[model samples]
Target: MKLSKEMRGFQDRIGHQFARPELLVRALTHASISSPTRSDNQRLEFLGDRVLGLVMATALLEDDKSASEGQLAPRFNAMVRKEACADVAREIDLGEVLKLGRSEMMSGGRRKLALLGDAMEAVIAAVYKDAGFEAAQAMILRLWASRINAVEDDARDAKTSLQELVQAKRQKPPAYELVSRTGPDHQPVFTIVVRLDDGAEAQATAGSKRQAEQAAATALLSKLEQKQ
Candidate 1:
């Protein structure tokens, strides 16, 4: 089956020339569009997740021969997590090519992090099925080169670092509370407050609760560091 010009352009952007264009189409088809004749990307997402894990595991070990599993584990999580996959999807403009049903489209499904991440994984599985592991690995490594290189940076995300610090000090885990929510349902701003038992606290706002929590943790950590 021939692909539309837009999808072809997307293929070029991702640097994968699909031998089975149908797989690409299927990968872009979301559950919201499921029907008797149409299939969603759920199964493909499952397979692609394993494919991604294998590729990342091998890549991590190759990059550092002496690193322990403890060291590599968090890095692997940072790379393969849903948010990371969603970031890659955004980079490729995968959302634009997604085939969402009317309700999904109405609710901004294209920009949804979960949807984008799942679709990205499905696309990876499609590449693997259409070609082979070699082709899929090549695409993954190429697309994820920057993230792989910056694994250390990801390892130090504010929430994790803050947790470690508090644990070492024999304090209760930092508590995150939703302070407020603003804006429309489609584009909401979340205000999260991160507070320590020692009376230190910080508040931050972002498009998502997770992001807001991270920001709040970062702010409080910085303030604590300044005192020391």
Candidate 2:
């Protein structure tokens, strides 16, 4: 499985080349792009999820020796969250390099958050399968180093920050409502609305309900701050 000139350049930028280039292609191929009979990244996503968890856990443990599990769990979750994965995909411009079927391409599948996020995970799994754990860990760390700092500094805890802002204003706490949930069982996407007493509302989406709610709260807080 020979890589195209474009893919070779991509591998060079990411600092890793797949031993089995087909695995890299498969990892980039979403189910919407390829039939199950051919190949897709679902299995790779499953494996990547665990690999990602281990990599992030190890990094967190090494960085925060005094942190408790309770404090660490949210930070870990924030790091591996789909939104974070999609952020990395955008940084790498993965959407431009994705190979999609005609229909999926027409439907804007490349820009879809779920597709981008899953493709990122699949790529992680491919790197692990091609090189090994250390290679994958290095790739993930390179992409996620800044995000880990944000998590450690509490910059990623939008919900908590929003609550603090609301309290400072002497207003009642904002409330979150589930506006909608879409996507499959294994990878559900949620849209949530956060409402403040002043009739302001903001909406956001995340891979899970709680994450969506936090995003919504963050958005609401931003709006409030802008008004002030």
Candidate 3:
């Protein structure tokens, strides 16, 4: 199949030329727009996830030969997590090429973290299928070079750091509570509260629960750190 002008442009952005343009098309097609004749990217997403994991694992081991599994695990997670994929997708404007159904389009599917993350994985799979593992790995490493270089800082997110700080102080792990959720199903906002066993607490609101929890944890951790 021939590639569309827009998709070809996207190819330039990601720096990959698809031998099988159909793979790219399939990767961009969301389930909401799928039909008996047209497949979605779910299968590609599954395969891409494994490919990404392997590449990240190897990269981490190569970068930190002396690091133990305990140290590498979180860095791996930070690099391959859904949010990280979505961030990369946003960087390349992956959402612009997404093939969404009317309902999905109306609901801002292009900007949804889950959708963008899934599509990004599918795109990786497409590149793999179009060429080979080496091609996919090269693309991934090129796009994620900065993130991999800074994996240490990326691994210790606010929430994890907060948990470790409390643990070191002999306090129970911090707890997160969902205070409220509002807005439409597709665009709901979550308010989360993170509390330390010592009664220190902080609340934050965001589009996703994880984000809200992280914000809450950062706030509480900041307060705790100030006292030290």
What is the TM-score of candidate 2?
Answer: 0.68
Off by over 4 Å in 2: 153-228
Write down the lDDT that model 2 would get.
Answer: 0.83
Please provide, for model 3 over 1-228, each residue's C-alpha lDDT reduced to its tens digit, 9 standing for 90 to 100. Answer: 888899999999999998889999999999999999999999999999999999999999999774556457778999999999999999999999999999999999999999999999999999999999999999999999999999978887677889889899899999899999999999999999998899999998878887687678777866887888
Candidate 2 lDDT, 1-228, residue by residue in tens:
788887887787678978799988988887766774669899999999889999999999887774545456778988888888988889888887788888889999879898899989999999999999999999999989898877845434677877787788788898888888899999898999988777889998878786677667767766877878
lDDT of 3 at 227: 86
For candidate 2, list the clashing residue pairs, or say none: none
Candidate lDDT scores, in order, read 0.92, 0.83, 0.91
lDDT of 2 at 12: 77
Tell me each candidate's TM-score: 0.72, 0.68, 0.72
RMSD of each: 13.5, 13.9, 14.0
For residues 121-214, write the lDDT of model 1, one tens digit per residue: 9999999999999999999999999999989688656789899999999999999999999999999999999998888899988888976887
